[model samples]
Target: NSHRVTYIHNLFQNGAATIAGVSEMFKERKRRGEIPADEEITFIMVTGDGGADIGMGPIVGTANRNDNVILLEYDNEGYMNTGNQLSYATPLGHATSTSHVGPAQVGKQFQHKDTIQIMAGTHIPYLFTGTESQPQDLIKKAAKAQWYAKNYGTVYGKILAACPLNWKNETRDGRNVVDAAVNCNFFPLYEIEQGITTLTYDPEAKGKKVELEDWLKMMGKTKHLLKPENKEIVEAARKEVERRFKRLKAMSEHPDL
Candidate 1:
């Protein structure tokens, strides 16, 4: 049977909650034995940002026990179709209707949610993460995920795509955004196989550490976070980078033990 459920988080948009509710419904059906134990189920999560579909991560985490979950994150940080409201995926200082900048000038006060980390922590049997910019990598990850699902029972994959309008960039510049992501190490092209994390394309394996400026320059919204006058903000951003590196180090040390 096919069904769709909608979840509304503070009425921000219908995308996130919709995906979450549908997954939940299927799980409920399976638990009650309403559906045959052998029946196969697949949950498709579609959202613009990491924050909108936070529910999907855990659902995939739990549902992977008996089903397949595919997550797609459109790089648009805000509610693009809904008057461009700021979502949790919105970058640190992007000016949105909800986060308007005044004379005092402060944009979204919070950093965007890292949905990848949330899913990675789940330690699912099969997890694949890639960006749409790398079509080859994306296809490879998707194919492997399907293989795992068909043969091993469950799989989970996440893809990141560019959102030009939300990022105040031209649609024609989508490729540029992807290139920036690679150049800045903001979005590396990689895949997780059978719970093992491996870097697929490490152009910087021997290169210098990616600086915060690389990401900030491409993301207009995050530019304010580096205002020279705000020493505290600058230091905070640096600290965040250091913390991220540490996490990556930990992941590298143990991919799927």
Candidate 2:
């Protein structure tokens, strides 16, 4: 389908409000015949990691209202655009400017926020997570997101993007880093449509599963978590990842979920 797409860039915290306003305007225009009835203009709000953190309130409001818009969050784990400060998305024990590692404290203290589950709680029309390392998976999710936004109500999506600078990793290793994250179940590929969950890619089933510590070892920020002193923290994060993936797997198996 040949549809018009309108992209708006704004503060992550304001993305939801912007989309809501623009979507309403377009709907009114179409209703008044100002815009051709046959023409489709999809509204997309592009947000960053901060969106899932500071912008979460508006996002929940938009989702609850079932606004006709697509919210795309490029989550690099921390507030990469703002000097790599720790955001709620940053995993436990991951070093950022705000979350320092020393004898006093070791990286982030608490577990990271699970934005996917948060969005799923709103029961939006569609929600999914994708990463650039898996191009096909990302593309398919994008297409599905567009379709849901057009036919249903709100669609929320997250892409586990790489911030080489913040991650303290070489730019050339971006794909490998994200790939490791997927194989380690830190970022599983999945989609939830109309409250029905589906696992798009299963690393365990494909014999591609790797230990969570292996993924952590690939980046400097999280390497401390692998230390014996910080073993408890890394183990906690690993358990959380496995728990989430297992829950998703169970959901995918049950149709009434």
Best by TM-score: 2
Please give each candidate's TM-score.
Answer: 0.70, 0.95
**lDDT accuracy of residue 31 in candidate 1:** 91
lDDT (C-alpha) at residue 149 in model 1: 56
**For model 1, how does the per-residue alpha-carbon lDDT over 46-95 read when each residue is reduced to its tens digit?**
55663345455445544445444555566566777767778776655667
Model 1 scores what on Cα lDDT?
0.60
**Model 2 agreement with the true structure over 1-257: per-residue lDDT tens digits:** 14344455677588898989999988899899999989787788888877668888898999989999998898899988779999998888999999999999999988888888889899899999999999998898889899999999999998998898989888999999999999999898999989999999999899999998888888989888877998888888888989988988999999786
Off by over 4 Å in 1: 1-43, 54-65, 103-105, 206-210, 223-226, 230-235
- Clashing residue pairs, backbone N/CA/C < 3 A, model 1: 6-17, 6-18, 7-17, 7-18
RMSD, each candidate, Å? 5.5, 2.5
Residue 120's lDDT in candidate 1: 64
